[model samples]
Structures are given as structure tokens and as C-alpha cells.
Target: MSPSPPLPKERRIRWGYWRSMMKIELTRQNVHNEFAKKVELISGQNLFACYQCGNCTAGCPVAFGMEVGPHQVIRYTLLGLEEEALGVNTFWLCASCLQCTSRCPKGIDIARVMDALRTVVLRKKERKDHVRIPEFPEGFLEKVPQIAFVSGFRKFLS
Candidate 1:
């Protein structure tokens, strides 16, 4: 005889049990750095608290467009892999819509973390604006709506 499929309630219980039993530990020797400190200060989040569960990435609406998912970025940051953390377009693609924050089981405000990374990237003296107003063609700015131009600048610069 074929086995019956699990009921919704039973499925939920099994899923919860599975989640509770899973544990991920950080194995890297170096876990702290100036970059992580800066991110924690700016975002008011403990980078080490994230265990790479990927709930944030799973819920992010813009994750499809990101070069790296939010959870991976957090892992990179915690590991002091600044180049890996900052090199991806994950933070840039974040909509700041709070979806990731809402889905994080650890109560981490991941949107704030993305914002912090953006701030760090922009504040660096060597990094130039990915898109500068002065670099745009004169007619392009005039043709674009004021709100669009302002929002673009804020997204790329701030």
C-alpha cells in the first residue's frame, strides 16, 4: 500500500522540528575586523549573531537581481572578507523595504545592514560615485523626471 501524504499540521510540526535541530557554527579563525566593526556601529546590528540561516535572503524581494544574497553578505562581513562583502551588488540591489528584516528569525534588521554597507562604500575616499550627475548627458537629466533624478542620485550616492 502507498503511504499517505503528511497533513498540513503534521508537515508544519516536522518542519519546526527540523529547523530546531539544525545548527550552523562559524569555523573561521578570524571573525572580527575594522570593516565589521564599522558595519555593526552603523547598522546597530551584531554581525556575529547571524548564523547564515538565509531567512533574510529567502524573503528579499530583490534577491533575484543581487549578485550575492543577503545571508552570504552577512557571512562575508562576519568573516572579515571585506572585498567579498563589498564587491557584490547585493547591498546595492536591496530595496530597503524591510522584507529581509521581517523574515529574519534572529530579529536582525538586515535592511539596515545593507544601508550601512552602502554608506561605507560611499564614504571611502577612493571610491567614486557609481553614477554621477555631472557625468550624465545634459539632455538626459532635463528629460528625466525630477523625482527619478533625485532618487537615482540618492540610491547611487547615498
Candidate 2:
């Protein structure tokens, strides 16, 4: 049989980069933290149901721009790695189109999970006094009425 062709240099480099992901030691306490519980409560989805099928990430339209992607965020949450899960911009970049939700074989509402993550990140105890609107997408400001933006800012900003 013929030997397999050697991978291109760039492909090999990319493989190495993926192989260098951070390692974490999981424990019962860390895996059952309040953050994970809150996420499940807010999202009303079973975090343990996901089996890392990669379907959600594969179907996400903006996954390319995300630092961690949806699946990784869920994994981090399940492992009670709140800081790591919240640190990535994956939840912020979510388009909320439900593409990932639709593609999930486990029937998880991935969009809701993203929303819950956003809520947790934005409403941290230290930042509760300061509320601000998230950055509107390009062309969104132009399309939305000024009064709506004004009312929302006034209500949220307090």
C-alpha cells in the first residue's frame, strides 16, 4: 500500500495549535458550581445532554469569528469553568439566528444558552449598578428608530 502524503506545513502548524489547548483538572465542586446551575436555570436546557457532536459549531454561521464557539462554551460551563466560558467572545458574537439550536442533535437550545451566558457576564455582581446596551450590529442603528434606542437606553441605563 502507498504511504499517506505528508500534510502541508500550514496544516501541520494548525494541527499543533489545536493540540495545545489548555488542560484543566475537574472536580465535583468545580463541576457543580453556581454558574453552571444558573446557566441551566436561565436556559432551561440540560447541560449534560450535549455529547460534543460538533453539530452546533458546524452550523453556526459566525463560528469562524468566535474565539471558543458554542460547543466549547457548553463544555466549559459543564466543567464549571465559568471564567474560561465567560472570557471568550463566542456568546457575544452569536447572531441568535437559532442555526445552532436547529442543528443540535441533542435538542439543546444553543441560542438560549448563549443568551444566558450574556446575561451572566453582563449582570455580574460587581457591575450591577452600571447597565449598558450591547453594541448594535452594523446597519442596525440605521434601521432601528431613534425613539426605540432612546427608550431602551433610558430604561436600561437608569
Predicted structure with the largest TM-score when compared to the true one: 1
Per-residue alpha-carbon lDDT of candidate 1 for residues 4-123, written as tens digits (9 for 90 to 100): 887776456676777777664555456767889999999999878888889998888889999989999998898788999999999888888899889888899999999899988988
Report clash pairs, candidate 2. Answer: none
Candidate 1: where are CA atoms >4 Å away? 1-29, 130-153
True-vs-predicted CA distance for residue 78, candidate 1, Å: 0.4
Which parts of model 2 have CA positions greater than 4 angstroms off? 1-26, 128-158
Q: C-alpha displacement of 128 in model 1, angstroms? A: 2.6
Query: How does each model score on TM-score?
Result: 0.69, 0.68
Taking the tens digit of each residue's C-alpha lDDT, what string does model 2 give over 1-158?
99999998656757566666655777888788888899999889998899999999999999999998799999999998888999999987887789999999889999999888887876677765554445556677677799877644433343
